[model samples]
Target: MWDRLATDGLAILVIMCLIELIVPSRAKGPVMWGFNLVFSLMLFASTLYYAHFGSVPTYTALRELHQVPQIKGSVESLIEPEYFLFFIDLLVLAILWGVTLSKPKSMRLGRRPVWKIGVAAAGVVSLILSGWYIHNGGKIENEIVQAENLGFLDYQVAAVLKENRQNDEITDGNLGKTKSEVKKLQATFAYKDASSGKGNLQYFGAAKGKNLIIIQMEAFQNFPLHLSLNGQELTPVLNKLAAEGLYFPNFYQQIGQGNTSDAEFMSNTSIYPTGTIAMSTGYGDRELPSLPRLLEKYNYESSTFHVNDVSFWDRSKMYPALNFTHYYDKPSYTNDHFNAFGASDEELYRVGVEKLSELHKQNKPFYAQFVTASSHAPFNVPKDRQRITLPDSLQGTELGDYLTAINYTDYAIGTLVERLKQNGMWDDTALVAYGDHFGILPKLASEEFISSELGIKYNDQVSRYNIPLLIHIPGQSSGKVVERVGGQLDILPTVANIMGVSLAKEGFTAFGHDLLNVDHNIFGMRYYLPTGSFFNDDVLFVPGKGFDDGTAISLKTYEPVTDITKYRADYDYILKLMKLSDAYVKQLPKRGP
Candidate 1:
């Protein structure tokens, strides 16, 4: 904390000196007090944000602040008693303020010409020191490390400067040229098998001409798939689905600031979230090349269902951007007393089945997406609504509540499956259900705490980011536990492969590869992890300022890898790939208003 003092301290000093030089002597106290309060509040928010998201809060984060009221339960859950210590200094300040108010007159620190000159010089000196601190840390692609090195206030400023620099790069990139460069670089990675000299024809046409149904489960994790709480299976329905489908146990979420919405964006578009902002909020105006758009050529009518308002997370714009033929939101579903755009996952699927069954009767193939919210943060489900019985250890605990919500979510999907079968749409449809992101935040349930409770070796980041990806193609009898390391970005290409849709033939530019065909794969992640952090077939590698001080842990074994020099090339490749992805998405043509 002391080492970080240079950045924040210098910044505060500059501000204090500036106020002294500019403000009236009588009003100085109130102004400084207000500044202090704002500073403290920002620090407090940053702390809680780090606790919840495991990333430093930047100015970009403020754009999502408007979303806080909608997720008030989640925000409240993130707060702790100890976090109020950030405002302890304010207690004394407030008391002093009251005493000063009660007094007959206020004392003034007389400011002469020499004193003003000294204050100005001090401000200039402190400003330079703050800039120096920012300069030292700004080059770091790792946000967490940069926050530690530059302190919180300076880090925000550094982020803006870095963002501008990256913007310049984005502005300079050409769409056609970038698409070519992406393909050229991707060929070097060789996603398809060299031995077969073909695309993943194994799964090609596997579910061709079938309707598509994708369930974007909320805050669900991979660990609960085959696990039991006491004697009860936590997610029996999902376990059954995993048994019947191809499940990617090594899959991780690639969501950014938009979280669930970002998962949808990546799954549909095969584009990076840019990590700095929510893709839906930022690029909802662009005409995205998506699964819905791709399937349209094959005569598949696309629709999406969410229990929340379409305006939430700007999904109203994103659905159009993705070129969905239809969408169902709040008014389309029955409200079950879920407030502030929250809904039971069961109701969400119930409506999805009802609407899609109509399309089934019409004999039209369709692509339908359902984004669930029942298991969102601070997972709450009435006891009557819960599916699995919890043990004494988990009962009433956040972990317990989370498990119950996940179980209910899985059960809801089971209803969707049964309804599809009853509606005669099951055998002709490709069913896919995957978690949008991990449910359990570390602050509520620490790795050690969860490991002890569940009797499993739970890694904080590795297991936390590990979301389940299951694809159930019609007529496939048994399940295959795919061992390939994949992210949410891989969903589109993988689904396309199963449905026999060739993105290359359509001239579509995709940053992600077909997980089924990739013998070797590497993908970058940011917003949650540091910018240059990537997961390869072997390990999850995270860089320090650059690749030299980076660390690696085996993806399979969850053990640290000491010698990471060999993985440096993979790190470099992923960095370039993500940058190109960011550039490509920015270059996309805007939709006609």
Candidate 2:
């Protein structure tokens, strides 16, 4: 409890000291007290945020404060009476300041170097102790545990130090060396061969001359694909598409701090997000090896469409780094006041089809990506757009709101498909659709609530991160449900294979494998889960200080496995793989401003 208190107070002290440095000598006492009050309130807000998200907020999280207007309702629900205790000191100080102001004379410590020195020494001692605490934590992969062990202020410092160390280690490294290492590591594992005893590269280039369209659905989960509520299908459009395409029900989301944008980065580049920062904000300056850069060689024009401003997550820089031929952002679409994004998914698709149709008229094959925003957070859908009616019990609940939004999003996709078909591009295009990340927060939508209402067993970690991945090949009449588990990292390799782009032949390095061909798969997740947590064929393994103390849950049963000894190899392999991914990304050439 004392450690926790110290951890919480550290931010207040730093803020107070910074305020003291700028204030005039005569006003230092009251001004310092006022700033302390303000800083305390910030601490209270952080506490509430932590309670809801189950993760400590870093300084970088402040960049997302502008998103509060869109999620105000959800944010309000997270606040509690206990969080206000952080402001108790502020309250006491405020009352004391009022009393002092009311008096004719004020108490003043005039030029007391001894007292100032003592305060400075105290701050120095606190810093030393915090550093010592972090050192004692001993390299835990779990961010939550690391924060708890080192406290919040120290955790931020440690995160920076760790990132710097990673950058240093890969400073002189080359992608060729990393590619060789990855090949050697993969050769150690026994992936399933094709039926002909040849490699599973048979499907490569099956759609070489086809146009490509990828839809990155917002906050959509796998459970809604065929599920019905009140005899009404939740996602009828996606259901039909899944029936006619290759659907991977076992696919999971692997986004980090950037969330949707990170999903975009992974799907396009096949590299892992560092989990310490938003990939778009941090590595957007790197000359990223992506689908756009590869397809450019085939005379294909690459473009991406989104309803939000390109500056929202720094996509302006990211697009150029990925070498996209063109992009359609907010100005390119009609604003329909769709949440904070300013335009509905329908408007986005309308604009997208118009632009792609122009390219099609010129007989140009193109790569077009649509980033949906209608089903974003706080999940409120306009009444006119609502397609599914909720049960009386869930009418005003978060789950109901989510379903309503998802249904609207699905309906909007139908419009895009219709446009494609009308333009005569459907038969010649290989369309891929996937969800960027999970929607419901575990605090609001508990396991019991989901199982009871949705009739689906929802494990917090495993099921919450599960998203749908569907790929529709032109003229393909039946769907195939691939059981292999995959993540956002696998999207690029899988799509490239379908497009007949050979990463190996082109000397491109991919941290992920082609999900359609790989018999066994393992993917790492670090944002919502711990850094070392990984999902394999049968289980989700989460590390606890180290492997021996770690835990495993059966993916099939969502129940804890008694013995996790057999999964040790997966833990080691994933840890090494993620480390290599981090190193490889750091070593990439940075694009100039």
Candidate 3:
């Protein structure tokens, strides 16, 4: 019973409650203890159920809690039916206790009103519990099926610790020879694999190394370009760039590091963001085979530049880890100081133009990375920087603030392109720009507001994951839109493929395919598993696990899948991917400050 209490406090609550009724009704403090235990146990049980067998509501709640510093909304919208059911269960136990104590012989103070209260309480609890059971009968049954396979029920508190602390790795620090110890731990628990492709790894592919410039935009979504107030364009610069470059219509962002830095790391290195810490915060200064490092082998001078504090998210450490030879942070750009956030996007572009000119003087092939910062939380753009105007219908709020930042960034992109043309490198340089992930807009806003701005349903899985990817190679003329499902993880391998570099066989294997080529159809699992989210062309499946309360959403008709077992086989692959990412993340360097 003691062991049971440790493992499941809620189960013990039910037993304790029954025991209290055996005692006389006059036993005041003990009866109060039982009630307190029941309340505490119910809360604990809800948390345990979420930890072990959390369905959609639980998972969503967890994700929302970890949202970036500024976004605000209620987490109640994401809760599943299990939360209500748990309350009903506790209520029923409460009513049952009241009923027996209400007997006249058992309690001289017992009266008709006491009986009345018992009946009302029982009726309410019974109604709620029965309704929930009826509505989610299949889900509850499915959960019971999964529960049958339970082992020690050891809680995985690691995920919670990771979310809160953001820096505790499996190993104490750099594991050294104990790297093997970490590896053993991963193998013992079955960590996920991070790589996905089966082809030969490539390194420096540039026979004639042209300069490379990668722009990872923060919170840049496709919505503003699609927005039309009475058919007026909100984003002219974005529209211009779209026409000038190759836009990937189906490109997706597999969220990493919980924000822009994560997307930048995965896209730049093609490695899963797992283990001790996000590559940005943890591995930036460590040795890693990122775009800069890979390009360095081919005599390409590589540098990373960001329009924010170098210390923000620890990019100062990450840029060096990826082997960038030069790094320019906020202070690097003169006349560009505005917010503490970083240099404005326009100034970052201006500095890029200057740096490109300086690199031209050096007469060396170069790789430069720019991480934008202003479009991040707070979402405010400077008065001079704000280029796009919103109608009266869209003024005075965070959403409007976010829209202005995006427009300003788009304008900055246009200015940079023009700068490239002026420098005569427009024809030779390869330019790649993409959003790190979805913008953290408030979900509580009107659906029409989101749909109008983004050109798609804002809450849809596709909209959540889908962002823009643009690759412009002058004189390539092949501007056709590629509709294959791809992700931020595909960026490194795809760029390597374009540059003709071969990767090391053991060190780096890409989870993404080369989108420039038409051969591979690899798609990434979008969310966590055994019951998370999966993406394919024909359908979008979101299976709720630990219970039958799973959801499968279709992209085409916006249909939800009530019965998810039809795709049970897919869960195997999803779990495999999860293990791989976890394993490799554990393998990442856990260096000290």
Candidate 4:
């Protein structure tokens, strides 16, 4: 506490001292007070961001503040009464200022020569101290530790400095060279032999020449796929689909600050999100190589559907950048007031199928992307729209609210499936469904709370991030559960494999591999987890400072792994892969107007 206090106080003192030197004596107090008030709000925002995103937010996060009103339910739920303490000082200041206005008394701090000299000396010392803290903390690769060592305010400054230094180290050029380097890197790294039991070409061309419909579900996780609550099945529609489709139990989310949109970007592009900014806002100017773009060669028309405005998260810019033919958002759907995002998942799919039916009539093979919103955070499904009933014991609980919301979302999917089958499109469509990210927050549903309530073991890190990835190629009879560990980045490659699109022949560069074909897979995660964190087949590795100070947990057992010596190369390889992904995306050519 003292270290953080000293770090925060020193940065404020340096700024205040500088303001005093420039401003008139009478104005100094008021100016410094106003600046401090703004600074306090920044700290409060950072705290709240950490509470929501589980990461120390950078200045880039401020760009997304306009979205707070759209997600008001989730934002309001994040606020605790104690969070208002940040403004208590301002209230006291306001009261004192009102009393002073009656008396007309002035407060000055820079008039005296001695006071000015002391202030300058104090500023120099604070500047030196804060600089030392930033320099030390800035070198740490793990952002969580970096935020701890350097306080919130200084951490932002360090982030800027680090980014500038990195920017200076590289020069932008063709993505071809980067792709070549990526392929060479993958070739050198030792991948686990992936072809002992299954056929080397299993599932290839399984859904060839089929219409593609990818459903990105909101806040969906894997645990509920086959689970029950109070004698009620949580997700019957999804359970049925899982029993008949391809299920990936070891898949996880790889979203950045953009949350849902980031998942969409990574799944389509097979590229890592930089974890510093929303990919839609940051890289939407670039022409992204995506599943839509790949299928366009085969005369497929790609269209995306969401119930919100395209302006949210700048999807207006992203859809075009991804070479999508059409995007149906906001005005395209009927608002049933299902959640803060406006329409229910049922409405989203209903509009999706309606639009897709027109393409089917034209004999066009379409790629339809449906983004669901009914199960968004602060999961409050309207009582009337709810599909499942909760016993009195679980009524108002966070877990209970979540189950209700997802139950409604699942029931909505049954509508889409029936409508597709009615249109004679079910057998001709490649339906891929996956969660955008983790739903349950740690504060509301910790391991102990979940175990007591659900009578199941839950690892906050392992199980919390594990999301479901199911792919249904219409003609397949029985479901196959693939145990390969994968992230959102692998979605495009896996889908491409199923659809018989040869990425190699197309010269398409993908950072992720075919989950079905890869012998052993290891993928990195950041933003939520630290930079060095990764999940391979056996364990999830999270670094504190670096490799030596990191911890690993068994993905299968959810128990701590003591010795991490063998995992060092996987850590080093993921870092290199992500760095290449960052550089590759950064160098992508801007879309022409």
Superposed by TM-score, candidate 3 places the C-alpha of residue 512 at a distance from the truth, in angstroms, of 1.7
User: Which one is best on lDDT?
Assistant: 4
Cα error, residue 366 of model 1, in Å, equals 0.6
Prediction 2 TM-score vs. true:
0.92
Instruction: Return the TM-score for each candidate structure.
Output: 0.96, 0.92, 0.66, 0.96
lDDT of 2: 0.84
What are the per-residue Cα lDDT tens digits for candidate 4 across 399-491?
889888888888998899999999999999989999999999988877788777887888899999999999988888899989899999899
Instruction: Score residue 524 of candidate 3 by CA lDDT.
Output: 43
Question: In model 2, where is the ten-residue run with the lowest total lDDT?
Answer: 103-112
Which order, best to worst by TM-score?
A: 4, 1, 2, 3
Question: lDDT per residue, candidate 2, 1-593, as tens digits?
Answer: 46576764664465555455446676876777766776676678778767655566777777767656645666787777778787788778878767756755434332466656766666676666666766776488787777777776677777777777777778767877987887788777666644537655746776888999999999988888899998999889989998988899999998887888999999999999988778888889999999999999999999999988888788988999899989888899778887867899989988999999999999999999999999987887888888888999888988899999999999999999999999899899999999999888877778789889988888888888899999998878788888899899999999999999989888888888898788788889987777889988999888877788888998889999989998888888888888888888877899986
Which sections of candidate 3 miss by over 4 Å? 1-208, 230-232, 282-286, 335-340, 452-458, 504-507, 518-531, 546-549, 561-566, 588-593
The stretch of ten residues in a row with the least summed lDDT in candidate 1 is 103-112
lDDT, model 2, position 324: 91
Model 3 lowest lDDT segment of ten: 149-158
lDDT of 3 by residue, 368-440 (tens): 8888776765566778777667767668755677777777777778788888889987767888888887664
- Candidates 2 and 4 compared by lDDT, better number: 4
Q: Report the candidate with higher lDDT, 1 versus 2.
A: 1
Cα deviation of 502, candidate 1, in Å:
0.3
Better of 3 and 4 by TM-score: 4
**After best superposition, candidate 2 residue 52: deviation in angstroms?**
5.8
